[model samples]
Target: MNSLLPVPPRRHWSTWALLAGLLLLVITSFATLPLKWGDFFSADAVRTTADFLHGFAPPELSPNFLLKVGTATFETLAMSAIGTIIAAVFGALLALPASGRFGKAARQATRGVLNVLRSIPELVWASILLIAAGLGPFAGTLALALHTVGVLGRLFADAFENCPPLPAASLRINGAGPAATFLYATLPQCSPQMLSYTLYRWENNIRAAAILGVVGAGGLGQMLKYHLSLFQMQPAATVIIAMLLMVAAVDGLSYVLRRAMTR
Candidate 1:
């Protein structure tokens, strides 16, 4: 028999089921959303949006504002660096246990902890820290660090795990302890992936820092909010331009750094 008896479709495993569930949630959410798609094309909506955009005029010369922008930009850089460094250090520290190269029991415990940590969003963490730290870059930095730790730690552990065990295991067999083998073998293999993810996160943090002002963290986003409230489109445009430039610069630098490391 040629088995025309209807072949089974793919089995819905945990991953596929999760994806399907998410799709259903999105479908249900769209049904409840207040927005109408037609509004984007509506005359009034277009006119209003155009008028708001127009308010952001001649972003050419604003020396005082530029200086302020410069300071805010620096603050953003500082925040991203501090947060990322803290997260990277701590994440690396914790990721080892999850690598399963150490022991089965430790790997399970570490993975469970990492799962809990990675489950929460950075914004939620930021909001909570904002409460405890009372409104500043400190709160934003802490928020980003805490969240980054979870993300990068899990990623690091995975990268470590995915590497060929031969090199590390050989070192261990030759009397290398877990730490020694990691330094010589596992860390090097994961280095490229780690750097790439870290750089990506750093870029994201720049964008996140810009908007953390909604929680009173204070950055160019705060300035943008102020300008929008007062209907100062020109200055707002200037801030947006500056952010674009900053992000572009970060992207370029990261590309160079990654190439250098890989080479």
Candidate 2:
């Protein structure tokens, strides 16, 4: 009997070339890293790790320590929430221009500003702000907000640009103004996606807020650093647990909100 199925299409030359190039790049990149494999699993390393880990047993659960951790936890949450809110507002404003709602010159200018803002890591921003604003949650909050604006603005602009043009075009043809077209057509399509991005960034900012505290920005990370510096592993462990719990809670909330949005 003759075979009924058609032959599968062969991979394109460009695909194979791209794969080969990626393989070469990965090999070259791996060769450049200075990895000391001999020390990684050495007996001394194992003993040191075990000893350090031993100290973390029975985390500090004292009333005062718990109270302090609770306060720090709230601070981190507030910083992340406020930073995200400010970034969303500012990012949306910039995104309008970057999305080409404005002319090409405006888009280029807005994008350039976003590139500069997002190029610097949050920690670097925090470090600089610390010098100017003095070490506190304020500096950390600003750092998170600035970096997030870059990220969110870029994402929002892309979302707006990718929105279906048909509805917007129809609105424009019917004498709807640009603002009305955006409000009725462009926004409705992309707002859900923008909200999803904001929530995801908020999750990241929470983790960043915790780390920023290590630089004396005032959060749980500062507490973790202090305890670790004094070799107080139990207290450090408590902080770590608190960080894990906070991250989990945010993740859970994001999941719920995202699910609701999809519906």
Candidate 3:
């Protein structure tokens, strides 16, 4: 009875199950990898990479190239902004049903739609839209909006669902209609979180828009692709730098806005 003993901590069954699943998935993924280790670090690969780097030694700094880059930068910005705005509107509309405000059947249907929309990558959507809309930023904007609506809709719905129901319930108890309760109580509680997600999506869309351009959706990506195709690495380097700057600027703006919202 006086002997010292160590006690084992308790663990939930689900926790063990999750760990098993993760281990299995990792094992499967490793097995599936098509690695050719012998060729990976070969001398030819190293020399080819060095040759490419040599071509990028000096980026084109001429006034004409800078002006072209500046114009494409604005176009990219416009496409992302417009796309995010449209997605926010559509996402908000779908979020209500997705959050179960309209009963189970409607909720399931709306959620299914959102899942489908988000499951298809934006690049795929852009390629499909490109055929219908032709080569331009318009197709890219549509692609961004579609995929973002699905993402923001799911996010907004989750934010709404996670909010404490007390305030909305109180409003309802006082004879407030569903719409009024949502407007005066639920929306106010969730708007900041929704806005934060929207801003984050906008940042991602900026990068997506650039890539979409390579598919003929029209932006700095198109210019970069053109130069790279011709082996004009100097101008391609300039375009790459411009892309980095644009991404950094959007990231900074998103950070400031998110901080302001939290404050």
Lowest-scoring 10 consecutive residues by lDDT in candidate 1?
A: 53-62
Reference-based TM-score, model 3: 0.92
Candidate 3 Cα deviation (angstroms), residue 1: 18
The local lDDT score (0 to 100) that residue 35 gets in candidate 1 is 72
> Residue 51 error for model 2, in Å?
0.4
Question: lDDT of each structure?
Answer: 0.83, 0.96, 0.94
Q: List candidate 1 stretches off by more than 4 Å.
A: 1-35
Q: After aligning candidate 1 to the native by TM-score, how far in Å is the CA of 263 from where it should be?
A: 3.6
Give TM per candidate.
0.84, 0.94, 0.92
Estimate the lDDT of model 1.
0.83
Q: For all candidates, what are the clash counts?
A: 4, 0, 0
- Top of the candidates by TM-score: 2
Q: Between which residue pairs do clashes occur in model 1?
A: 55-233, 56-233, 56-234, 57-234
Name the better of 1 and 3 by TM-score: 3
Q: Which of the numbered candidates is closest to the native, going by highest lDDT?
A: 2
lDDT: worst 10-residue window of model 3: 1-10
